[model samples]
Target: EPEVTQTPSHQVTQMGQEVILRCVPISNHLYFYWYRQILGQKVEFLVSFYNNEISEKSEIFDDQFSVERPDGSNFTLKIRSTKLEDSAMYFCASTKTGNIGYTFGSGTRLTVV
Candidate 1:
């Protein structure tokens, strides 16, 4: 089965630093979404991307956060000025179509101090 792959399984950074989390969605998938889960909290949607554009975003995806597919392949989430509260496990998910089941990357655990 195809799977989404995220780099740097874990990361630790100082407050106010910048972080770029990378992800490669399933090759055949057409829709992609970024989500985050605080240590013990429920998953929270951040943004959705399709057709090389961001289709929707949650309030949590404020100016500090941005998503982009720089090339035809990988997707990336950049978090500027990271804060302690921003520490969480970021996941990348992809679906062949909106109706199909999603394949999610294990996630990148970010720790902000």
Candidate 2:
């Protein structure tokens, strides 16, 4: 079966630096989403994109964060300014239907020092 893939499984950056997390979502899917898990915290939705525009984004998706579909299969998240609190496992997910369960990439671990 096809699966989502994320590059640089782990990333370490200094606070205030910019970071880009890359993900290649599953082909043939129409909806994509980004979520983050802060250590022991619950998975929080950052943003959902469809039809090349943002469908929904939580409060956490502030000016510091942005999502883009630079290519057919690639979805990327750019953090303009990293913070120590930004450390988390960022997961990329996709689904054929927005309401259905999603298939998530292993995740990219961001560690802002």
Worst 10 residues of 2 by lDDT: 93-102
lDDT of 2 by residue, 1-113 (tens): 99999987999999999999999998999999999999999999999999999999999999999999997889999999999999999999999889697999999999999
Off by over 4 Å in 1: none
- Residue 99 error, candidate 1, Å: 4.4
The residue pairs in collision within model 2 are none
Instruction: Give per-model TM-scores.
Output: 0.97, 0.98
Clash count per candidate: 0, 0
How far does residue 41 in candidate 2 sit from its true spot (Å)?
Answer: 0.8
Task: Write the residue-wise lDDT of candidate 1 on 1-113 in tens digits.
Answer: 77799998999999999999999999989999999999889999999999998999999999999988999789999999999999999999999887479899999999999
Residue 105 error, candidate 1, Å: 0.3
Best by lDDT: 2
